[model samples]
Target: MKKRKIFFVTGARSEYDIMHPVLEQLQDSGEIDLQLVVTGAHLSETFGKTVRNIERDGFKIADRIYNLLSTEDKVGRIAGLGSQVTALAHTFNREKPDIIVVVGDREEAISVSLTAAYLSIPVAHLAGGDIANDGNIDNSVRYAATKFAHIHFTFLEQHAQVLKMLGEDEYRIFNTGNPALDKFIHCPRMEKKAVQPLIEFNIQDEPYIVLIQHPIITEVENAGDQIKETLEAVIASGLKCFVNYPNSDAGNFAIIENINAYATKYPDVFHLFKNLDRVNYINLLRYASCLIGNSSSGILEAPSIGLPVVNIGSRQRDRYSAGNVIYTGYDREEITAAIKKSVFDEKYRAEVKAIRNPYGNGDSASRISDVLKTIALDDKLIYKNITYKVF
Candidate 1:
């Protein structure tokens, strides 16, 4: 039998990390030809040019789309999305892959799905049906991608049901859990001493926090203030912090500015990083006293490690959590209280450690790979029908 060519589009470090396990499984399969298209923040120097990490992982790059705009605002973001669509259309026309796979609700996922739909190509969208009605603009983008996607690989059964309500055919949707959890589950925990050198922090003896807050698109003007509140709270907690850079969204520049300012002002208490490979990041979470941020990592991966999360603002408001996350607003006092509860409250900490992660069982990659290998590539898969009943 001829091998099926599968194209996977990854735009940022976080998205790539979530999709890595699935990519590995597909690449190792004898019946599949995996093509990875690196684009968005992966190709931008300002975002640490994470494409190097992909190369370091030893996956052969099929193409690179330098579509990210230097301007960090809403207008620039839209322009970049348009550029991605144009670039991907040309690449897809040249490659003509049997299937194109994308993950999450970022611009990359929607751009690929939209372009593929226009070209009559089947698109497999992972994490399509998840909801995070946190005024981040991604919630709407996620649903838009679902409409264009031919196959849905959701992380939860509830998410799959969201696709069904969105008119997606049931046969095309698969509850493969989250492939991100596969990496977290199998990753061995490193001792604090071992992790300290990697993150450049002395965390062996003292408790610390992992902070990863991002800018909310709907509240772009308040981006700087929002992060300031979180930083102040984390600082007040008196725990050393390892702060990761926010994603390349519209309001990210403001968040980055605040992060840099905080890092400079309190160099001893706060450490800033552009990026960390998945291994270091997972281990960082494993040993952290608490995680403070609105990044999806807090909602999805942190719980699996039994890490308490103080999810600030609305970026992940409606997303399902495993009782390990504490949601708070943008007020510094409220944020500080949440952090206190997450770290110093012994009862809360114990309960969090005992909670089982509902995300996945670490086999999502294999399941997704199996479906990709066997799902028939034909008109039935390409032409989608609404599964909704009008009566």
Candidate 2:
């Protein structure tokens, strides 16, 4: 049998982590020729040189393209996406792989998905049908990726149903949960000796919180004000706040700067980790007083571990949540109040710990790999007809 060529695209650190298992599986498979196309923050000098992380994980790079914006602004983001689409169209046509596998909702993936769809490549999208952030652009991009994609791995069965209702053929959408879940199933319990040196802290001595909030790229003007209000609330909450690095997006420069400045002023209460491996981040959440902010992981991943989450603002306005989550508006008082409750309210903490996650039971990689193996590759790709019935 002739080997079918598969081109997997990686745009962000987290996406790379989620897809790592599939990459390895495909590498070992005799029937699939895996070609990895890496771009976006990986190609950029900033963002910890993401490509290094990929290489360290033992994947050979087939193609490397740069689509980083010159400035972190609206104009820069638009220019960068346009750059990605143009470059990816050229590369995808050159490789002409049998499948284009995409994951998550970064703008880089959006650009690459458009390029693949135009070139009529069979796209396999992972983690579709979930919603998060009014201004994050993920909801629209994820929905758009689903239509062009020939295969999908939603985080749950209901999400798969939603995709089918959106006109996707039931066969094309699979309920594999989020591949990110695979990371948890393999997580080695962190020892104090190993973790203490990994993060610089007064953390072992007192309570600490893990926070991740990216720019609401869809809304440019509120970036600074939103971070400011959130910072004020974090400080007022009276707990040691450990903020992680934000994603590289337009308006993120200001947010990063503000966080750094805030850290310098209140070194004891404010802690910042420039980068964390996914395992460390998970372990930290396990011990954190509360996981706060708009990161999708807080909503989807934290609940599985029964971690308390204080989700804020319009950033995560539409995502599904479990009992572990407590939301608040962008108001500083509300944010502060929510944080205080997560730390001090005994009943609320107990309730959060008892809620089970609706996301997955951790077999996403195998399920996703199976779907890719079975999908039909046709010459003409179009949306399949859906059967709707009157109730």
Top-scoring candidate (lDDT): 1
Tell me each candidate's TM-score.
0.98, 0.92
- For residues 1-391, could you state the per-residue lDDT of candidate 2 as single tens digits? 8678888898777688778777766677656777788987777655777788677776767788887776866788778779878888889888788888989787756776778877778888888877665756777888887766777878878788788778777767778777776676567778655675777776676676778888877666677787888889988987888887677778778778888899999898787876577677777776788888777778777887778888877777767778787888778999989988888899988898888778776777777776677677875344445446556
lDDT by candidate, in order shown = 0.89, 0.78
- Local lDDT at 291 for model 2: 85
lDDT of 1 by residue, 130-152 (tens): 87767677888899999999999
Clash count, candidate 2: 1
TM-score of 1: 0.98
